[model samples]
Structure formats: structure tokens, C-alpha cells
Target chain A: MEESPTIYEQIRTSGYSRRDFLKFCAWVTAFMGIEASGIGNVVRAMETKHRLPVVWFHFQECTCCSESFLRSSHPIVAEIILDKLSLAYTETLQAAAGYQAEEVLYNTMKKYKGEYLMLVEGSVPTDNDGVYCCIAGKTSLDIVKEAAEGAKAIISWGSCASNGCIQAANPNPTGATPIHKIIKNKPIINVPGCPPIGEVMAGVIVYLLTFDRIPELDGMGRPKAFYSRRIHDTCYRRPNYDAGLFVESFDDESARKGYCLYKMGCKGPVTYNACAVTKWNNGVSYPIKSGHPCIGCSEENFWDNGPFYQHLASFPGFGIETTADDIGLAVGAVTVAGIAAHAVRANIKKRKLINADIEESKKEGGE
Target chain B: MEDQKIKRVYVWEIPVRIYHWLNALVVVTLAVTGYLIGNPLAIQSSAEAYLGYWFGTVRFIHFVAAFIFFFNFLFRIYWGFAGNKYADWKNFIPYTKKYIRECYDVLKLDILHIKVKPFISVGHNALAGLTYFLTFLAFLFQSITGFGMYSAMSDSFFPKLFAWVVPFLGGDFAVRQWHHLMMWFFIIFAVVHVYIVFYHDYVERRGVLSSMAGGWKFIEKDKPT
Candidate 1:
């Protein structure tokens, strides 16, 4: 079997000039937040290294990750990245079906053992012996275990795979669990978003390919280069949040004027993601920019964190309509009422004791 | 009947009195600002976003109060080690059999409303000491979670030290929830603490409130030690 050409040769054959290929390398390097000095190194790595074989697996997911990846703004992302990388098996993108797809998966595993990358989308269902999500007559759990054993590193593509998005929300019927929970031994990198930005997905892949190692990850196994700061920090309307100018309602004047959506339960402050910086659909706009508050889809248990349109409040149903002042005032009133009642009881008890003392004194006098 | 004389016993040292008032101020500031941070007032300002900065000011006040609260609590801990017996760290632990007995006696007298003679201690009773110890732990938790959340925004090394606490406690949202809940704990503690102090002042006639102010607690000279 003739060895497949390097990504550079593939790019050259595809009629992209040497300049276009170096520009692609520099663009990916910039996305990875590598210093300008490392651009040549990135170029060298891309020119020399073979495209790593990626086995993309889908479980209980919305297929939004693949959709996002397909929509990458870069011209070569779909042409070069999707086509050039040896994507041996993917349910959504693969041309082969059934036995042929299974053959590719097994062949890739056997040939590139301890070398291929595993990209898991969505979460694996554990209930009823993983009956909820099955592929090719095998439970996703079984497939994940089999594939993860041979992969170099695993990338949990979305919140479903990273922190068990909506599938693993409250009363998770399927017992859907994130990849990291089941595959404990593997070096897992979590790129968590509802459907993480395409540029970020490419950035993660490029960083891995260039450095031959995973990017510096934060405590949650997310790449620090992208997920280190919160969306709130980089948001354009942050000054409004700092200034206490909030959108009171979805259709209010503040919303029209692009004030902060914090009062409307924007989870930007608590959610860590690169959405505000990278944006979505080719740096056009994110949820916050499009007159909607962040649902915090990237954070853990976001679906259970309460309603999307209401800020974090003690009471579930009384989030947007009721202010903390209302609760504080009510508590204050109750505290005062209790104090008053206690005071009245204490006063009556004191008076009774005083009366008893006088009666005892009078009885002594009579004696 | 013989006349009763009052002996003024210096219980709270200057450092303890200072710590008490400072802690009270810091706690109040922290609770108010912390509540505001969680549930910011919808201030409709006609001024530009940069000019208004009202929420930022609230956050700044909260952070400042948090630092003071943390350091004041630390100072109190140090005073517990270095100050007199009344301010001793040993009093807070309640490990000794006598301390445990005093705790039970105080609990009976206060909560159970039993007519048991109050366990007379020059400083905080065992129950109060234990409560204060728990409050200290709560203070530590709030600091960890608060700083942990702040670490994301701040570039300073002090706040960064607690960055791991957010991930350890699950995430930023959970950390905020726990931090907010702890604020209620402080508020409740303040209410109960104030009531108990006044009640003790009335019953024991030890000038509980004034002692906190002046560092002198008056005791009946003829009373048993």
C-alpha cells in the first residue's frame, strides 16, 4: 500500500499555492495563540507530519458539532481539514455504511494503534445496559471503551461529551454520562459548548498537531488558550454590566440599546467559553450579541441551573419577577414579626413573675 | 442582708475588642455587597456605560470587604493564640471534658429553657466558642469560593491562589450558590448572637454589650468562681 501524501503534498495537489499553505499554518498558529516566532514551526510541522487519523463517534447528540465543524469560515477547513485528515469512521460524515464503516473503524484502530485520535460527540448512555444509544448493534459505551483503548488522546467535542449537556439534564432517563467519567485512564480534552465554535475546534486540532501534545488545559480539562477567561470578561457590553445598565425585559428599551443581559439571567459571568471572543458563524455574533442572554450551555448542569431568561435566584419560579429586595424585605418583616412576638411573650412572663414575687412578699408579711 | 459589690473583670483585650468591631463592620459590608453582587439592583442610568460603573463599585466594595473580613478573621485567629485566656484558641475547640460540660449546660439554659445555673465563664461560653469556631470555618469557605470566582477576572496572585476551589466545588455557578447561601449563615449568626448577648446582659448583669465596647465585664464579687 502506497503511503498517503503529507498534508502539504495534498494541499499542493489540490492547486493551493505554497503561500496559501503557509498562510493556513500561520492562521492556525494565531488561533492557537502561539507567538509569531512559532509560525515557522507550525508550518514545518504541517509540512512534515502525516495527518493524524481521527475516529469521530456520535452517541446521544444533536449532530450540531459536526454541523459547526462543517461551517468553518476558512475556505480550506472543509476542503483541506475535513478531506485531508484521515477521518476513518464518522457516522455523520462517512460515505461507507454498516459493515464498510465498521471495517474502516476496526482497520484504523488496528493499523494506527496508540496513534489515532478519538473525537467523541455527545454522551454515552449507561442505563439498561447502554440501550439508549447503540451504533452498529453495539452500545456506545462498548464502542467508546474499545476505541479509547487504542487512541492517543480523546477530545470530548461538546458539552454532551464533556459535561453531559441537556441529555444528562435533570432526571436523565438514559443515565447519559460524559466521556471522562467512563474513560478514566485516557488524556481527555474537553471542548465544551452547545456546539463549540468551528475555529476553536480547528484551533484545538491544529495545536495538537503542531505541538504533538494537548494544549494547556484549565482545571475542567478545557484548553486554557480559549476557555481560560469567561465570556463575561470579553463581552463588548461588559461596561453596561459594570455600569449596572441591564436589559429588564427581552423587548425593553435596554435590550434595544444593547445593555447587559445580566438581569435577564445571562449566564455569561459564570460560564467559561470563547464564544464572546471567537463569536459564531464566522465571527459574526454570539447569543449575547444577538439580543439574547447566554444560556450557559457550556457550563456543567446548565439545564438544571434553572431557566435561561432568569438570573440565579434562591427560588426557582420567582427569578425574573421577584428581586432580591423583595425577598430581603419579606425576610426582614418576618424577622421583625418574630422578634415582636417573642418580646410580647417575654413581657407577659416577666409581669407574671413580678406578680408572684409580690404575692410571696405579701404572704410573708401576713405570716 | 449583706451588700453585694461588683468586681470589674477585664475580659476582652484591646485586640479582641478591635477585632470584634472590625469583624462586625466587615461582615455587614460583605453581606450587603455580596447580596448585591448576586442580585444587582437594576440601576437605570442615563449616563454612558463607562461613566456609570455602579455595579463595578458594588463589586469593588464587596472585594474590599472580603479582603478585610478575611484578614480580620486571621488577626482574630492570631489573637486567639497570643491573647489572654479569655481569647485563647483552646477555648474555641471545646475538646476538654469541662468545655463539653459547659457547652451542655449553656445549651440547656439557652435552647432547652431549663432553669440550670448558667455556666459562668469570663469570656465566651463553650457554646458561643463552638459557634464562633464554626463561623470561622464558614468564613474560610466563603473566602475560598469568593476568591475562586474572582480569580477568573482578577490578575492578582492572591485571588489566583483560590482558583482551584471553583473546579473542586464543581463549577463557578455552584461556587456562587454556596457563597450566596453562606451569606445567610452570617446574617442569622449576627441576629442570634446579638439577642443572646443582650439576654446574657439582662440575666447575668455582666454588661455584655458594654464589655464588647469597653473590654470590661462586671461580675458579682461574691459569686462562685
Candidate 2:
């Protein structure tokens, strides 16, 4: 391995000041929700640790994961994160071609065996000799296995690499499979989303660089810090839900006012993610904030769950089965009873009026 | 059977009655509208295909009624502690020895059809009181969990307060399953409650249903508490 220049030297060479470096650490500390005291640790790690070696692989995906990753707003996220990270081999970003790229991957695998990070960006195909996808006449499964064999840990970039995405959706002809399903020995972190927020991707990488290990993950193998709360939990229009103010139509006044989208086929109630809180574009707006419903891209198999436009029946209401329809059925039955009561009361009133008329006629006849 | 009118005092106030009826109305509305949204029962009218006005109107009514029912829950909880002897917490909870014995007597009278006279009180009967008490507990749980689920979207204060439930129920998927199952329980409870109320009022000639509307029921002169 080459004796690389220290991060400070690289930062100076890269045109970033010492003050800028400290500010970046502070920003990352806050974003990770760590205390100010922890800022020193992150700064120390970044300054001391050698640049992390990375090998990124792509298969059976739309490349949206890489698209989102490049959009990270943090200055170092683009500079120190992607640039100084010693990204030796990546099919999407690497410029080297043919034998040169393959040579770099093989050298990195041999040089930093069981030490470098392996980031897989897409799902692997398994059927028919894995012939559905190939690079340099080799199947994607073989390529992933060969690269993953020398990696310390792996990060599945998105839903495609984590849970097979739409490729594994209905009849999965190519036998598409997530990275975790194929590799069990390595510690795999699944950052699931159609395309996860750019900052979250940066945060995960930062956490790994700072902590030198994978962050705590939920049962689904997603980092707990980001996926802890549902998008619904952090949504701004929640008051409208409690108030029963819902947007009935896309063009309705309620929709314009940004009322709750629960009635309008929003899966936000059942979907869990940090979209509403962390948001996109520097925390400016999320799907719900942008007048779109959450399709629950973070959760597993969101595509197979159902149509995105149709509302779920009973969302976890009050942690109970208080679905909008269940509540409606209960009300409909009561309304019918109310109507019956109204009919009975009206009949009795009519009968009394007729009796009074008969009595008046009898009195007039007698007179 | 003719029963003589007695001095049976009104235990439920106008607010209490309003709360009760309003809750009933809203709960029913929520169940029906909620069902249609989930399963989407087959449409009967051709206009429903192009317009969907009826479904939309039902949903609007359902949400409005839910707001009222939620308030009703709040009011009832308050009344359970603040109201008169009958509406008070002591009446609902059968802790006293005499009330426990009365429960047995009431059950015996019901089973044997002994033609025994009715007792007068502002509160519910022992069995009825127990069921209502359970319903209140269910309502409280539902409110907290519902709010937990609700705040999940808006990041409201309620979800923050009850955020611990997310883990206890095993993530969003389990929470969703629990929420779905509990709705059916409420629907079943509502169905059985209506059936028994109507059966007593029409078949058994007990006039129980009328008491909800008129605030009183006639009892035989021979009855005593």
C-alpha cells in the first residue's frame, strides 16, 4: 500500500482551509445528532485515518442511487467523501476503461484484503448462469462475489441492492436477488429507498469513516439513526389529520392548503422513513411537503405492497385497527338508525295531526 | 306488560347524551368509510364510476364525525372523574361488595325470566356498566395508538409522546397489522351492541332503546333498589 498524504495535506492541496475542515466536522456532528463534545472525535478520526478504499458495483438497477449520492450538499461530501475516499474502482464514476479498470479492482482486492469497503449499487441476477447481466463476459453474481470476498463490510446502496427493487417484483424472470440474500458472512448495511436522500447516504459513509464500523441498524438492516421514525411522524400536516381535515381531491382547496393526505391515497401513515424530517434538497421539502403522497419507498417490497395511488384500508390508527373505512361503516350503520328514528318520529307526528283533525270535525258535526 | 311510572332520576346530562350519540354516530361513520377505502366494496351505481361523489361525501362525513367522536372520548374521560354519582368513576368500577352481589342477582333474574321488577338508577346496569367501562378502556388505548399512528405523518406531539409503541409492536408492519385487526374488533363490538339494544327495545318490550332518545324508561311500581 502507498504511504498516502495526511488528510490535512490533501485538504490544503484540495483548496479547503483548516477552518473549513473544522466547520465541516461540526456540521457532520450536528447532522448525526451527536453532542458538541463528539465533534472532536469525528475531526480526529478524519484527520488521522488513512483514506478509505472503496469498490462500487452496479447491476440490475436504474443508477438512481448514484444519482442521489452525487447530489450531497455537504462540501466534503463531494470533496473528501467521494474524492479523498480512495475510491479505487466504480463502474459508474471511474474513468479507467477495459483492462485498466479491472486491473485497479484486482490490485485493490489483493492490497487491502478484508479492509476496504465494498458498495453494491444494484441487485444481482441468479438464473440461467446469471446471464441476464454481464460485464467483460462475466456474470454479475460472479463479479460481486469476487469483489465482496476481500471487503471489510458492504453497503447496499438502495432498495434494488437491498431488497431487489422492481426487478424482483412480480414474476422475477431473471431471479434477481438483493446483496444481503447472497452474502451472509460480511456485515451488510442496507440503505433502502427508491433513491435515499443524498445526505443520508453521506451520513452513513461519514459514520463508517468516523466510527470505523457500521452504525446501529434496525431489524431491516437500515441505519437506525435515519430510519427510526416514519415519514408520517415528522410530517407537517399531521394537525389536519387529527382535526379530520383531509384533501378530498388533487385539485381541491384542501390540497392547496396542504391538509392531511391520508384520504388522498398517501401511504405516509403506514410508511416509515425520515423523508418528512430530513427531507430532500437541504431539508427544504419532502414528498408530503411538496404535495405528493409517500409511496413508502424505504420499506421492503413497497412496489409489491400495492398500487401507490390507492389508499390502504386500516393504517395503524391509535395503534389499533381504526381504519377510515371501519370508522365509516360504524357511522353509516348509526346514520341508518338515525334515519329510522326520524321516520318513526315523523310517523307519530303525522298520526297525531290526523287525530286532531278528526276531533275538530266531530265537534263541528255535533254543533 | 304495563309498568307504573316511578321517580327514576335522570343520571345522564345533555352533554353526556350528546357525547354518547355523537360518539356512536362518528364511530359508525368511521367504520363504514374506513371499510370502503380499504376494500372498496363493489360500486352499485354507474355514476360512482365517473363521479365518485358518494364515496367522497361519505369520506368527508366520516372524518367530520371522527373529530366529534375523538372529543366525545375526551369529554367522557373527564366526566368519569368529574360528574355526578352515577357518571363518576365509582359507579363504573364494581369494587363494592353489594354491587358484586347485585350483579349475580341481576344475572339470575335475567336467566330465569322470574318476572322480577327493575331497579332504578342513573348509571348503567352492572353488566352494561362493565361493558361500557371496557369500551372506555378500549377507547383510551385507541386514542393513544391512533394518535401515535396519526403523528407518524405530521410529527405531532402525540406520536412523540407514544413513540415507544413502534418498537413494542415490531416496527411499522406489525403496527399496521395490529391497527388493522383492532378495527375489526371495534366493528364487531359495535354490531353486537346495536343488535342487543334493538332486541331489548322491540322484542323484549324493555324500552331500553327509547331511554337513549327520551332519557327515561318506565318501571313497575313494585320495583325497588
- Winner by DockQ: 1
Give the TM-score of chain A, superposed on the true chain A, for all candidates in the order listed.
Answer: 0.91, 0.84
Against the true structure, what is each candidate's TM-score?
0.93, 0.61
Which model scores highest in lDDT? 1
Which TM-score values does chain B get in all models?
Answer: 0.94, 0.76
| Model 2, runs deviating above 4 Å | A313-367, B1-178, B185-225
Quality of candidate 1 docking, DockQ: 0.51
Whole-model Cα lDDT of every candidate shown, in order: 0.85, 0.72
Deviation from native of the Cα of residue A5 in model 2, angstroms? 1.6
- Per-residue alpha-carbon lDDT of candidate 2 for residues A1-367, written as tens digits (9 for 90 to 100): 4678766567778998889989888887777767799999888988887778888888999989888878767777777756888898888788998999999989999999999999988899999989999987899999988888889999999889988888987678999999998998999998988898888888888889899888998666888788877676678877565445667778976777777787676877676667887778777888888898888886666675555665653343333434545664676587667646644653454455447757866996698
Q: On residues B1-225, what C-alpha lDDT tens digit does candidate 2 reach at each position?
A: 332444445666666777778887777777677665444433333121223345456656654665577778888889878776667776667898877866766554433333345564335677667778788777766655655554444455744676666545534644554555566667767766776576445432435777677666544355565
